[model samples]
Target chain A: EAEVAQSPRYKITEKSQAVAFWCDPISGHATLYWYRQILGQGPELLVQFQDESVVDDSQLPKDRFSAERLKGVDSTLKIQPAELGDSAMYLCASSLDVGGMDEQYFGPGTRLTVT
Target chain B: AQSVSQHNHHVILSEAASLELGCNYSYGGTVNLFWYVQYPGQHLQLLLKYFSGDPLVKGIKGFEAEFIKSKFSFNLRKPSVQWSDTAEYFCAVSPTYNTDKLIFGTGTRLQVFP
Candidate 1:
């Protein structure tokens, strides 16, 4: 089965350090999403992209976090000067299109921990 | 903005026991409902979804959900469960059909004991 790919399944860094995570969506998928899952909480959407163009990033903390999907295929999410509170699981997902009714395929996710 | 509510924070069940997880969404307009499960040290996986059609939707691993439009609820049920079914379950809702943004509930952790 075709699946979304993510790199750096685990990460640990200092509070002031920078970290980045990568994701490659399934082929032919046009919509990609980034989510953060804190312990004991459900995943929350951080950003959404449609064919390389950002559709929504209202929830993203732009001051410290940035995500880009340059070629409308693969994406990268970076956090500069990571904080202890930023520790969580970053999940990437993709679907054929951006629709509420459409099902999404999820990647294994990158677990980030800031000391 | 719409929001999802999961009634149970944690659940414990024995093997072969029936299981039910409550989920409700607060949306007046047409919406889409979904349930996702996450095993230990794994990413979230879609268990089932309800868009249009029958209210009773069946999903993988002997799971099913019933969408009650009037009640604004989509509850997951399993007649018989196994130890492998232990995981964290989340209920999510999308307010419209055009967007992929989803509002997720806190989630319920189910521990199925052998």
Candidate 2:
């Protein structure tokens, strides 16, 4: 089975520091998503991408967060000057296309701990 | 804006017991509903989804859900559960045939005892 790959399964950073997480989606998937999962809460959408082009980012905190998928394959999400409340599990998911009932496959996620 | 709500925050059950988790969504238009499970140290995996034509949808591991449009509810159920079924379950909703953004419920943590 093709699985989504994520790097740095765990990260610990001081407040105001910068952190970056990487994700490589399943092969041939065209749509990718980034989500933030707070403790005891469900995942919230942060950004959506369609083959390297951003489809939606309304919920993304643009002031301190940014994501890119230059090649439409792997993606990177960065948080600059992280705050204590920014500690959460950052998850990445992908689907075959933007339509139909195709289910999104999620990565293991990078757990961030901001001090 | 769409939102999903799950009533139970935590549930405990013994092996061979029946299970049901409540999920409701607030969306006026057509929507797609889904249930996802996250095992310990694992990523979120789809349990099932409801699109169209069927009010009841069956998923992996003997899980099923009923989509009640009038009530805006999609409740998950299983006749018998095992210890391995212990995990965090989430309900999510997205506008029908629209974008890929999904709104998820808080989540229900199920602890099944052996």
Candidate 3:
């Protein structure tokens, strides 16, 4: 089965350091999403993209967090000067389109820990 | 803004025991409901979803959910649970049927003993 792929399944870094995670959505998928899952909490949408253009980023903390999807196929999320509270599981998901009717497929998340 | 509510924080059960998880959404308009499960160290997988027509929806792994419009509830039920069923389940909602955003509830952690 075609699956979304994520890199750096685990990450540990000191506070104030910079970290980045990568994700490659399933082929032909036009909509990509980034979510953050804190321990004991459900995932929250951070950003969403439609064919390389950001559709929604209202919940993303722009101060130090940034995400970009280049060429509309792969995406990268970065956090500069990471904070302890920023530790969480970063999830990537994709669907055929931006329509809510289509099911979204998820990728194994990257677990980030800040010391 | 719409929100999802999952009342059960954690549940423990033995093999062959019945399981039920409560999920409620605070949307008044037509919405989409979904349940996703995440196994230990694994990614979230769709358990089931409800869009329209059927109030009762059947999902994988012998699971089913009933959507009660009056109560604004969509509860997940499993007749018999196994040790392998230990996982965290999340309830999510799309505020509007055609909207692209999804809001998730806190989640429920289930631990099944053998």
What's the candidate order when arranged by decreasing lDDT?
Answer: 2, 3, 1
Per-residue lDDT of model 1, residues A1-115, tens digit only:
8989999999999999999999999999999999998988888999999999999999999999999999999999999989999999999999998765567889999999999
Question: What is the TM-score of model 1 when looking only at chain B?
Answer: 0.97
Error of 2 at A73 (Å): 1.0
Error of 3 at B69 (Å): 1.4
Write one digit per residue (lDDT tens) for candidate 3, span A1-115.
9999999999999999999999999999999999999988889999999999999999999999999998999999999989999999999999999888788999999999999
True contacts kept of each: 0.90, 0.80, 0.83
Better of 2 and 3 by TM-score: 2
- Evaluate all candidate structures by whole-model CA lDDT and list the values in order: 0.93, 0.94, 0.94
CA deviation > 4 Å runs, candidate 2:
B97-99
**Cα lDDT for residue B57, candidate 3:** 97
Worst lDDT window (10 residues) for model 3 chain B?
B93-102
Candidate 1 deviant stretches above 4 angstroms:
none
DockQ of 1: 0.76
Residue-by-residue lDDT tens digits, candidate 2, A7-90 = 999999999999999999999999999999999899999999999999989999999999999999999999998999999999
Residue B102's lDDT within candidate 3 is: 84
Task: Give the range where candidate 2 chain A is weakest over 10 consecutive residues by summed lDDT.
Answer: A94-103
TM-scores, all models, native as reference: 0.95, 0.98, 0.96
